[model samples]
Target: MHDPRVLLDPATDAVRKLARRGYDLDLDALEKLFSRRTATVSATDDARAESNRAAKEVGAAAKRGEDVTAARERARELKARIGELEEQQRALAAELDEFLIGIPNLPSDELPDGSTDDDARLVDTWGEPPAFDFEPADHVDLGERMGILDLARGTKLSGPRFAVLRGAGARLERGLAQYLLETHTERHGYTEFSVPAIVNRPTMTGTGQLPKFEADLFRTGVADRELFLIPTAEVPITNLHAGETLRAEDLPFAYTGHTQCFRSEAGSYGKDTRGLIRQHQFAKVELVRFCLPEQAAEELEVLRGHAETVLRELELAYRVVTLAAGDTGFSARYTYDLEVWLPGQGRYREISSVSDFGTFQARRAGIRTKAKDGTKGFANTLNGSGLPIGRTLVAILEQHQRADGSVRVPEALVPYVRFERINPDGTTS
Candidate 1:
């Protein structure tokens, strides 16, 4: 959420910047809401003052030994009026809050033009897509041939878009997750955390995943409690400091976590419906950071580099692209998506997204930074997928597979998996 003071100020260029994301922020309608709220607040204050005066008048009449019935009755009337005004004030406040929460973070003025992924600006590319003498098979065909992935069983158990990894495929997913967690925590200076896969409504909203994206979430509850399955570790990991204040000395905090993410993939019909490219549930290693507003720019690059480190270590060919305003996530002011080259798909697919949310998420989550002099302000937040395990596994299988149908493990992950390669027979060798 944004600061109401800045958003409501007529002089601010908020409307223009928000337009970059293709969002039409109705300043006139918002002004009316703001004016109404202000009037309601003023009325409440006036009624409170009048009630106080009425109480004093009744007290004086009682002290003078005069009949205080009418005075006391007037006081009671004032009390009732104040109650009505206060209720209005509360209702108006809630209305304003809901309106503000629906608005997305303002896109940075420096962002490239346009709103969709096709309009994103390409930053750089790394390595090269591998050459294959034989026609490259997609992850699904390769996994099935190796007797590792079972899609039919997955569908039978939970319907379409679900996958069951067996034998080497399951091991590969686990190995990839472990390798990513290790690389991030040990070398990237990130503190590893084990977070819950389930979070409450506030926790979900704290990261800007609620209300707007509820349709894409898996909601569950027992009795009267409302809970949601996290779509990514980013949701839980970034909210670790929600409603907390940290000293300026603790300027930047880096955290990493691995979690099983669930998504309804709402409205995504007939898209990547095959294989591990899109799934109802998948594992991912996430990275999150909190820093002073001034440090956000540098933090973004550093965080992106940490995610890139995983790809570099695994020798995966990938490219980085800066997302346009509309393509960026709700809480992110700017984003960099790392698309790994998949020879099987004959194109680059997103495997990680590094974003700098400025103070957008911090304001929503109530994470503040207290300066040495005692002044405080919201902290800036950023997060990225170090790598989504399913996609990474897909890239590995397709990129490193031999013409003979065996898949060679990347050198960096060999130690973790305790094998150099997975044979065509689904045996480790």
Candidate 2:
């Protein structure tokens, strides 16, 4: 939720800055509510004063032994009127609060404004998309040919947007996550944690996934009142500081966790329907950070590098892009997405989205920090996919396909997978 004070702040300069962030602030509605609240408060004060004065008059009248009943009655009426106004004040405040919750955060001035993909900038490209002498096949086609992906049975069991990863597809997904987790914890300085895939509503809402994106999530209909399957580990990890205050020294706390995210995919009807790109369930190793406001942008670069390092290790080609304002996630003020090249599809696809939320999420979640000077303020939050395992698997199969029809496993994951090639016969070819 945006700070309500900014909506009502009397300073002209402050409002202009707010305007730059694309916030109109509903100043008229705010003014109307403030006027009502102030008037009610003033009326309540007057009522209480009048009641006190009446009681004093009654006491005087009683001392004089006449007209005491009329004065006492007047005080009772004033007290009842004060109670009524107080109730109205509570109602008005509640209404204002509901309105505040619906307003989106103002986009930062640095944000690129456009509804389409134009404002997004591809900042870096790594390795080279392997040039194939023979024609390359898409992941769906390669998976089908190699007996790795089974979409038919996935549909028979779980309906659309689900998959059955057979043989190497399943193994590769697990290998991808393990490889990403170890790389970050062992080399990237993130604390590895195992978090609950089913989390309560507050946990979801705190990370800015709920209320706004609830239709995209799967909630438990029983047991916990408002529990929902986490859409990503980012939700749980980012909420680590929700409703808590951290010390300044804890400025840049990084956490990485793996989760099997569940999504309804209600709006994405037909896009990416062929392969592992879009699914009802997918495993991802998410990276989250709690950093000082000044350090957040720099943290994003380091965070994005952590994701790119996996592709680098796998010897996969990829590029990083800064997402435009309209194309970025709800909670992200600025984002850099890493897309891995898929030779099969003849195009690059997103595997990781590294974002800086600034104080947007921190303010909403009440995630804050106590400064060295003892001043308390919200911490800037950042999160990115260390990598989504399914997409990485897709990229691996598509990018490394050979003319003989077997897919070459990346050198980095071969040890964990215990093989260098995925043959159609379910053996190293």
Candidate 3:
């Protein structure tokens, strides 16, 4: 949530930045709420203190054998007034919390002062799309022809946006996740973790996925009030330090984990509905980090490099794009989306998105570190999908497909799958 001080600090220049991100902060409304709250608290406190003094006076009068009836009446009146004011104060405090919780995070200074997709910049491509003699088929057609994916039965078994990866298709998805986790942990510096797929609402909201994207999530029907299936490992992994303080030496924490992410696809109708591109459930390997504010820029570059390495080693063509302020995720100040070249689709599609959230999430989660002077504030956060296992599987099948209907697996994945090619007949070539 945005800091109220953003509106008060003139030197911070948050108004123009907030305007760029589509936020019209109502400083006046907040001031009114706070004013009422303060008045209510003061009235209640004054009444209680007056009542105590009056009671003491009445007791001393009785001790002196004097009349105490007038003092007793005054104390009774103060007690009644304090009770009424207490209720008003509680209500006003609740309203303030509601307003604060729903507000969006402040954008970083480096974020372009704009609110549109056109503001985005094309960074560059890592590799070029491969040339094909024949018109390449999309993932749905390619997987179906190879007998590795069954879309019709998958929908029948569950519903639309769900898939059944048979034979080599299943192996490919597993191999993709393994490759990503290994790259992040072995080659890069990240702690590998296995976390719960279902978590509480606080965990979801902490990662900036709840209170807005709730419709896109699949909540557990049996216990919807207590748990929601995590949309990404980013939810649980990034929130590990919630409600805690870390030492300065423990700065720049990085972690990697793989899990099946569930989405309801609430608003996306008839978009990438045919194949693994858009699924109700898909597997992904996630990377998350907590770092100092000054370290966020460098951390973003390092994490981006880790995600790009997966495609590079697999020899898949890909490019990176910097998301505009308006196009970036809710918790992120900046983002870099890795788009892999799909020969079949004839265009690059996003396979991974690396983001630097700055201190947006950390503030919400209360994850912080004490400064040398003993003051504390939110920690900066960063996360990315090393790569989506389901989508990467689709890209590999379509990109490495041979004219004879055999799929040449990436050389890096041969050892994991125990073969280099998956023939059309569901046999190793």
**Which candidate number would show the highest lDDT if scored against the true structure?**
1
Candidate number that wins on lDDT, 1 or 2? 1
Query: Weakest 10 consecutive residues, lDDT, candidate 2?
Result: 12-21
For model 1, where is the 10-residue window of minimal lDDT?
A: 3-12
Residues 141-195, candidate 2, lDDT per residue (tens digit)?
8888778789999999999988998877788878787888899999999999998
Q: How many backbone clashes does candidate 1 have?
A: 0
- Which runs of model 3 end up more than 4 angstroms from their true locations? 12-15, 38-83, 112-118, 221-224
- Residue 277, candidate 2: Cα error in Å is 0.7
Top TM-score prediction, candidate number? 1
- Native RMSD of candidate 1 (Å): 1.6
TM-score, candidate 3, is 0.90
lDDT of 1: 0.90
**Residue 202's C-alpha lDDT in candidate 1?**
94
lDDT of 3 by residue, 1-429 (tens): 656555456775656666667877776787677778878899888888888888899899999999888888888888888888888889988887677666666666666545555576689887778888877888788789878899898899998888898888888877777777777888798999999999888888888887878898887745446789888899999888888897756788889999999988897997887789999888989999888888988999989988888889898998888876667777787888898988877988889999988788887788888777786777889999988888898889888988877789989888778789988776875
All candidates: TM-score: 0.96, 0.87, 0.90
Candidate 3 RMSD computed on C-alpha atoms after optimal superposition onto the true structure: 2.7
